[model samples]
Target: MDKHTIMQYFEWYLPADSQHWKRLAEDAEHLSQIGIGMVWMPPAFKATGLNDVGYGIYDLYDLGEFDQKGTIPTKYGTKDDYLEAIQALKQHGIRPIADIVLNHKAGGDELETFQVRKMNPTNRQEALSEPYEIQGWTGFTFPGRQKQYSDFNWHWYHFDGLDYDALHEETGIYQIVGDNKGWADQNQVDTENGNYDYLMFDDIDFKHPDVVAHLKEWAQWFLETTGVTGFRLDAVKHISEDFMADFIAYAKTLQPELYAFGEFWKDDIDTTLRYLDGTNYQYDLVDVGLHMNLYQASQNGADYDLTTIFDGSLVQIKPQSSVTFVENHDTQAGQALQSKVEDWFKPIAYGLILLRQEGLPCVFYGDYYGIEGDFAQPSFQEDLDKLLYLRQHYVYGQQTDYFDHPNCIAWTQSGDEEHPQSLAVVLSNSEAGWKRLDMGTLNAGKTFVDYLGRCADKIVIEEDGWASFPVQGGSISAWIEESI
Candidate 1:
């Protein structure tokens, strides 16, 4: 966790204005000043259209460079604008983490007649249709790009399957079956549908040597061209675990210290851990289980056990590799998969992720800045910022957790020698409560103030180093040893 804080640079419905890169570049200094060490930018490569949100990737070599998809730039900005933004962020001392969507590709140049077989929706291993010629959108000539970066071209041979048949106007999961051509083994995934590898569009066949080769080549070029220091892999569950491990190994040749993570997005921690193990622990994963716990706590409130917050969570198991977050683009209001943590409990969730010294915390853009969509959600910027401020300036020490209570949990961090300010964090899902805990003999008579303003008072420690700290109902309080 070299960079303690990271920001998912874009949300799902970020305005299709080409000036997003410019604004981000300008805000680099401001973000760094506010303790954001890195930004995980959306995919910079040219997508299907200017409105694709950078996920429906077309040409990896095309980073809004050529006149592809009737636009010179992607949803964010042009290639030059993207490079400038990365440079600007670098100037402000923030490492830009590029989004790598290697799992699948979409928006082909045209349809090609290819032999394919439909896999059963419930069981992908069971084929319902025989291999037959069908017109599918797998041709990606990238005419606009003119193969500028790499001469490698994508055709039906490059992919293992296509989901949609344009001639028939039908959609079905088709696996390109042959001696070795087909969807990557679904056995590696954990799902009721046997495997969830086929998420959207033309899924890439990682088993193919050419596909893997092109990906590795493009990664090198992307690093050299954009100078991104890290990566945020998209839809990694669809790709082979071994391929991901090899990709990281190959990428490290260019950037040895590259901080990379994948969106495994599992319901349980076991699957995520298995994926990490399968990849030989090459990168970290998003702590989705913690997010689910937060959502449950928001729903159940006092009924939810406060002590079980870290149960079945990556942060509790492997603290260092766990990138913790409250809500991201997917969990925002009215997204593809919406499970918004209640606004009332947002501060509490942020407090938990930021105050505790476990995982690398990622503050979502939608959370920091009010979400923009059909229904706008209130921003918890102020509360989250203060916690981040403490994280940057005052959060340093040996942690002591008091998770005995069901509705309330408290912790005290013995101040490190570097910073003489110890922190005591307390929260409750139910009602107002107080914790009389020892913050170590280092502070016997020091006074502590709740920066959250929940208590509206400061408590002085007694001679034995114990003090009664209070918090409001359904709220969290972070007490800092008040500056003497």
Candidate 2:
């Protein structure tokens, strides 16, 4: 069976040319051929404007279908273009995943006077001032859409907070005053900033029945309209866990086998696990701890303990419910969560995720295709392609781990009946090193070579099916049986 690999197809600094959908459609076949089983497309909904990157959501109903947000087409393309891209991906046997941003709403149509209390930015639970009237952009009429899909006009009652006070021409965390309206419970959201329920923009009040109903309605419409097989939920740690669990459950009723994962963005494995539990394991979580480990290893270089790479990682404890990635749009340079793994460690990081049989690994588009903005970086396409090829063809069977060394680690996969192509992987963070690891006892005396072509010398397995695999300093090598 082929390994399931996911590719995040968009980056933070992509060109604002509205050709991303077309580019994805054009590259569908190539993506499939390169063993990408799933592709996570950027937010299809219209954002604040042309170059908003879809995070600052404006109109959920207007997916480039209306002239809202000052443009007929989104940063990617039009609605027709997005649907065509989905079809193209499906035709190529790739599951398309949509990015869902439900934590807040932005680009409201008009300002509305509402009663609010300024909350302490450091401690959201603390009210800094008494209730006062202020005009906020909490009215989202979506006039450009003209009530096309749904006529659910958002008002101040549907949200709990906002960052800007248009009436006062000032900025502060203003908690909207209403009955049963406040941030989610301390236990329901992240512990950061006292209570993390208030992220940015107009924070949706999950406790409100109208807000919950409309969100559910929109989710169903999004699924049926897009035909996407999965979703990549954004900022889950800030949203109410109960609502998320209920939403995911409701979504599963429509598509029983829907693949859902959230960006918790918490480096603490226990907190992430608590979220998974809180949501009743309704969806998987991105292994932020593992990503941090990779980033630290990259930064510390040889000083980092290679043997403890997976220590305290979600993948280490709950592999089945973890979505592993080296770097992502949020973690890329110049972003809020900019803990990027260095260039030299990318190959090693990719090797750890791609060649392993643990978590479902995801490749970042920025790393594979290169970043294209002020904090631009070169692409690792060549090395990533090689690792991906090895994963698709050579990686198989029972695994053996050799993580005794602090700087050098190695593992091997014993061939199975269907796939006889066994593989051995060796990596070193310090100086050059070699590990005498056993591939298997079957068919000894066979010759093996480094598929990465980093090492020129070949090694012949002994009668015991053991050979010393060599790798260069700060590099990784995947050794496989030489082709006949």
Candidate 3:
């Protein structure tokens, strides 16, 4: 199998307009200029019928062609507009990875029907049919306690500004209540259930064969139509593991090289590895625990040692598993660890992960340009230059070596036969003025250059055969020169 590296741009907050298509085309061109190999675009389907996050999906087939956002006129362009963006990326040698949400659909339509029940007191039983509550994270809670919607207002909707339907005794679908309440007057659903309103989203029954077939068809259509190289599965833990295994296997048949990874959202390495066991790692996963460790270490001003974290979990992962990125859209920002984007820890984290030999490395879009506040205003051109250059020139097709170290972490990458490029990176977050370390395993008495700062240091082997050097405080990283 050919190894691939990724420089991901999470276009999550991209505007839902025709202008965005042009902007994305420009962005794809820019990424290619900077040597980014893969670009990950956010979900482009219809909005969840609630927020603009795109995760709250209403219909999988509709790519935002509703009455409200008439912006996406098929007359303006067909799915071809998106394909053009992908083609532009391919022209620049950049692969496009689409971020997909297969777990659930926005239960908005269900909530709307439930609201009608509460307004009319004539048919109280229909309004009070089967009431179900959401049992996951909704980003809100009442003071002094944490509970589902059932624990709170039974009548209010949790997440949607509609009412929950009373369960029908015969069919599983909740019965809708009819009332004279105006659609605008319906209260916004709290993250919790209502006391009087009774609004809960209709969760997708993954156990249903029709639902599974629908998901597979959607995946097949995306791959066959857009020529998307891979997928980043959202909220995989919420759905059945078997469903994912089958879905991934089916997707690979369409595009054999397609890489599908999921966000399992667990800290335990064993638990995370379980999802990959039977499937030959068809569903690769990001290392959320290691990401958290790096963030925590940066905040404490401690040396960010990549080896320590890898030693704890790398053995458990499949050799071809995915292993890129420290901070993603879902995690805390890299700037959250410190106020500055140029913080030593940030570069060190990037260098170590990008040069590692194990899993493919991923570069977050915001991390490329020090995006501080909101993702909406992210600047992508600046920091991406250095990273994209390094990924292409040094990291791509290179064999990785994890150098032995305590406080300082280091790695070296040697390019393939056709591309004889090599680079070594060493990072120390310690405050010590100077530190000496062994580089005997690498070429002795050879000159090594730092890629980021352009500083060069000559390796000198002492009488005892140990390479020593001065490692400064904050963070220091160096890459060795290689025959191009």
Candidate 4:
């Protein structure tokens, strides 16, 4: 069908060596074989140090080529090595979705310009303007007592500490406090008014015209060079809503069909929909909050009953808007399909998402074959291939109808207008080995087959048009009528 398929890449997956590049290319091939139409690679731009997670960027143009241990990977060959991976994916009909980090930067007053301003010994106002803060979530504990910008040492500015005000234009240095050394690190600025530090890494003054231009430049380059299908804008909430509108508008000029989605972390429907209104929502957001409900129900041994999540107030959104995902890098790892409780839970979860009407469905790499690692693992090509085949033939590009019952939750997906035959899925949330479902209006006296297990069963529709059958042990499926 016309469903948008995406594969998420964790930050730790990108290797720093040539051997790693080869392995990554092979992984891309595996995903394409499994019917994945798009791949979202983690951030690969330049960074300050060994940031296994690439959110902390150092330069926009540099593609992490300092060294294997360092950000750059000349050791991994050259920039060409990276491009080869992208091209290889394209050959397999998979589009690349680059994860852009436009939020914050690393802190250290090592650059000469920033250090001069911090130690200005003269006017301190100019020093406070430097990009001083690190993004909040890194788990560093900065001393609360060192409040003044001058009192703190700049070298101590690590991933754990945040310095919100550290810019000094007079000295052209980013003034950051050091914890142990009692000195400030001086940072140099490449742009006029020492604005590069603010624009490239830290939260930029989004209202500034220059900031808008800088973002546009990156978008243009990305579209022109990589031919990426879309972007997963990182930290979009931190930027002003107005700036997002303007930036997306400019990006359209480069590729009119380019899809862009923002990461707005919230579970409530109203709160999530608020960000989607009045903006260029070509591809708006992923209903993470709704996914959470389904995930919780699965984990709680509710047998993947997805009624509460699907039956919630329907969000009136563009057909291809929101991106739906069960579990991502930030959330708890999805349950292993090998585990009895989790095995049936995943397929049922995918059933709910892929058969839904609102957004495109995303399948986490780990969910395919129950990989247990945090980030990278060997490919699950066999399982993924079968699942994708089923998704493309059955659920993808289909119109969905949702139904709910106290004992079970089910949905019907029909082919497009031209081909209307449909598949119905009913999931039982009981752990007593099996549960019976009354199929209302489902055709009776026809042979039905479970595609996953290749099991065949007869559907005997009663006089009341109800079909009763014991759902396969700990599993869900696409039940197709033999007559149709």
lDDT (tens digit, per residue) of candidate 4 on 158-240: 32123332332222223344433221122211122322233223334443454456567767766776676678887665455
Q: Give the clashing pairs for model 1.
A: none
lDDT of 4 at 285: 78
**Candidate 2 C-alpha lDDT tens digits along 1-484:** 2899999999999988999999999999999988999999999899999999999998888889888878999999999999999999999999999999999999999889999999999999899999999999999998888888899999999999999999989999999998998889988999899999999999999999988899889989988999999999999999999999999999999988799999998999888888899999999999999999999999999999999999989999999999999999999989899999999999999999999989999999999999876999999999989899988876778889999999999999876787788899999999999999987677488888998888987888888877888999999999988863
Estimate TM-scores for all models. 0.97, 0.99, 0.71, 0.71
* lDDT tens readout by residue for model 1, 1-484: 2237999988888889898999899999989888899899988888889998888888899888899988998999988899999999999889899999887788898888878898898877778988877788888888887878888877787777678977788899888766688666765555547667677888887888888888888888889888999999887787788888999989999998898988888868888888888998899998989999999999999999999999999999988779998888788877776889999999999888888789999999988988766868877788877988878866677889889899989998776767668889999999899888888777888899998888888899989889888989999999987773
Model 1 residue 396 lDDT?
71
Residue 293 of candidate 1: its Cα lDDT? Answer: 93
Runs in model 2 deviating more than 4 A are none
Compared with the true structure, model 2 gives a TM-score of 0.99
Output the lDDT of residue 113, model 2: 93
Residue 174, candidate 1: how far off, in angstroms?
A: 1.0
What candidate 1 gets wrong by more than 4 Å, as runs, is 1-3
lDDT of 1 at 448: 91
Residue range 1-484, candidate 3, lDDT tens digits: 1335565555333333444444567777666666567777767665434235566554455553443333342212235566787788878777788878765444332212232223333322334433344222222222212231112212223222222333332222232322322221112111112111222233344445555665677777778778888888877665556667788889989999887777766666766666566444667777665666666567766545544655445323654665656666666333223322234466666665655566667777666654444633345344445655776666645454444555665555556565455565666666533335444444454555555653445554454434544455666555545332
Evaluate model 4: give its lDDT: 0.52
